[model samples]
Target: MTGRLFGQGEVGSSDLIREAAKRAGAKLLEYELDAQFRCSGSDGFINWVDNTLDIRRTANVLWKREDVYEFRVMDSVQELEHAIRQKAAEGSARLVAGFCWPWSNPNGDGSLVKDVQVGTWAMPWNAKPDAGHLGAGIPKSNFWASDPGGLEQVGCVYTAQGFEFDYVGIIFGPDLRYDWEKNIWVGDKKHSFDSVVKKSGDRFVDLVKNTYRVLFTRGIKGCYVHFMDEGTRKFFQSRLE
Candidate 1:
């Protein structure tokens, strides 16, 4: 897998974490870098008639499960920042999960976000802020803000539903769902985008498309996309025209 450049001093995505925090100008409720593993195996194990066991080439099941070092609660913002900074710089990417107060997307551009190399980008499922005057459906998530300083420092979008950023820098990891047809995000089996769709219907789909749209549009003037599905690229090309 291709590695993403993140953080300060080639260490952690914390440079990004700090920048984002600064941009939002919000305090940290909590945050940390959590470790996880990408595991998969054959679902059905078949026995051979020859007194030996043969593993059939059945469907492959892949999923991310929490690995060693379960959870490390962060006390201060600096500690959380330092931990992520350290992880982003490591040779292998480690999973990190944490909580943050809430921020509003002031800009909402996709090109502005940067991709991280070492870890999956995740935020608190409940951190979503109220969409005050921005009006509903306009995308009031903090990920949609355009902070010139923040953009130059750390670029990427890593969060959940109901958010839009001026520059979305999604860190592609093993969990991403690939759709060869639409060439867009199919759905994360782990995160269960399908369930989100089922629960919210078109409203959910619209939020996803719009969330990605906001992510794609984050560029200062244009979008720089990498490793996208053919269908997704086509969708972008068609829409850009």
Candidate 2:
């Protein structure tokens, strides 16, 4: 089954597939997999996420299984990093962020530039695809989620997708923010680093929402997050309260 919640850039493949089948005069069958294998097998957690993100309304608005699956919001980027690192010692863990910063290439000395900066806190994005020779412990874009050294760098939606970790730390960037006055989520393309997604025009907001949905559900055991936007953070906190 395909999940539109995880769709990025343009429309998801399921839509295209359905359209093609209709045009070819072929009847298509679809099935819904209601069972939850991710987020500690808590279908409630998934529903909670959908409701929380304003993606759709679901029965599980507030998460009920705190003991079974962990979900936390951190005060700062530093706190998010520390929590993820601590979890990494016990099991697989990775830090991921929204496409809010430029992914810079390594220096001539094979040193990574800290492009993701929030206040005084800064960290480099995962190694570039052509990062021929990374410094001692850094992993290339593909292995960022699985490698031990991945903790040192921040990952974006591209590298973090299709991977599962025991725990995940996410930096909720300014690209997507909740408008308190209007009671809506606003997507600012100016704050987004993903040029391809920004080119999606009006669809950018939904894609950005889906990107976070993917990030939020990456952890099987737990997920921690740091929000750059205070109003947006408070909006999320209100849903739980």
TM-score of each: 0.27, 0.84
Query: Top lDDT: which candidate number?
Result: 2
The regions of model 2 sitting more than 4 angstroms off are: 1-36, 65-67
Query: How many clashing residue pairs, candidate 2?
Result: 0
Evaluate model 1: give its TM-score.
0.27
lDDT of 2 by residue, 1-241 (tens): 6463331233556778899999999999988777646788977788888988889999887765345799888999889999999999999999999999988889878889999999999999999776787888888777787788888998888878877899999999999999988988999999998989989988999999999998999999999999999998898787673
Model 1 collision count: 34
lDDT over C-alpha atoms for residue 104 of model 1? 29
How high is the CA lDDT of each candidate model? 0.30, 0.86
Residue 28 miss distance in model 2 (angstroms): 29
Query: Hey, what RMSD does candidate 1 come out at?
Result: 19.7
